[model samples]
Target: MTKFADIKGFVFDLDGVITDTSVLHGTAWHQLADYLGVAWSKELADGLKGISRMDSLEMILKAGGKENDYTPEQKVELAAKKNTNYVAEVDKMTPANILPGMKAFLDDIRDKGYLLSLASASKNAPRVLAKLELTDYFPEIVDPASLKHGKPDPEIYTKGAQLLNLDPAQCVGLEDAAAGVQAINAAGETSLGIGDATELGAADMVFADTSLVTLANIEKHMA
Candidate 1:
């Protein structure tokens, strides 16, 4: 097995990697769609996976054929409403909501002395981390609000590497979305994607799910 000798840090995306808050986000969006008389579908929910909040809202609005119906202020208000719903559900999340094998993986990463930080597009990332009781492992979370660009842009991953005081090349980024894998690659970091291998082809390595994300497994499989 090839060891990841040069890797010093791991930058993680929150929603799908740490927990499944995307369901809450989709539910919130669905509620907003209901308010706008728009039909919700799985494809629309899937499309929102790794993008910024405003971008997700824009996609939903366009899908509803109501993109032009609201002023900028009204759109912001609508997004806030959706956030309210998402927050209500996320606040209910406990460590039990952490994905399978993820807690052990986190403990292993921590014990092994790798630097850790977060690069999630979600503004609620801090809250979710706190809810999961995993904040001690990640003190630096790249602020989504401060970023000028979102996933597929590399800015968030680049900033996350900066937070760890490490070069992007010395870090490995973990994500569950195609856009996120692209961002990590563009940032010059090795991407470890957790999800469908075909969909996350940009990743340097792909695991079927969080349960398979062990470090030993990664070194065994990653090139």
Candidate 2:
């Protein structure tokens, strides 16, 4: 087992990593599509993962053949409406939706004195964290609002590592999106891709979901 002896921090993507808000986001997208008279498919929504809501809305509208009809202002209005619906939907999130093993894994890392932070593309990240009551676990959070570029750009992940006072190679990034895996890889950090493995080829390691993420597994890489 390889040990990352120099590693001092862990950076996680908020949506699919710490919370199950991906489902809510997908539902919102579907609702938005239906409202626009388009058939919503998981295949369509999946392509927008790890992007900002604005970008996702643009992609969705384009796919639905409404790009030209929807002005930027209108897009913002629809996106805001979707966000409003999403927030209401996810208000049901509890400690149970924190994934099967995330809390324990987070606790283990904190207990071991690792600096923890979040790098997420979601604008609703802070709200979701607060809703899940996981805000205390992370001292720093970088969202799309904090950067000019989103995932696959490496900016957010790099910024997150910098905020933790750690080099990119001295941190581990956890994400569930292909773009996020690519971003972490481009940032020159070890990345553990979670959720669907097929979309995570750029990751150094892959786990099916948060259930598979454990301190032991991380320690193995650190060894």
Best by lDDT: 1
Candidate 2, residue 48: how far the Cα is off, in Å: 5.1
What's model 1's lDDT at 202? 76
Model 1, 101-171: lDDT tens per residue? Answer: 99999999889999999998777889999999999989899988899987799999999999999999889
TM-score of each: 0.87, 0.84
| Global fold similarity of model 2 (TM-score) | 0.84
RMSD (Å) of each candidate, 1 decimal: 2.5, 2.7
Best by TM-score: 1
lDDT of 2 by residue, 39-107 (tens): 787679888766668888888888888889977788889989988889887786777778888898999
Candidate 2 lDDT for residue 176 = 84
lDDT of candidates 1 onward, in order: 0.89, 0.84
Model 2 worst lDDT window (10 residues): 1-10
The pairs that clash in candidate 2 are 2-223, 3-222, 3-223, 4-222
Checking candidate 1 for backbone clashes, the offending pairs are none
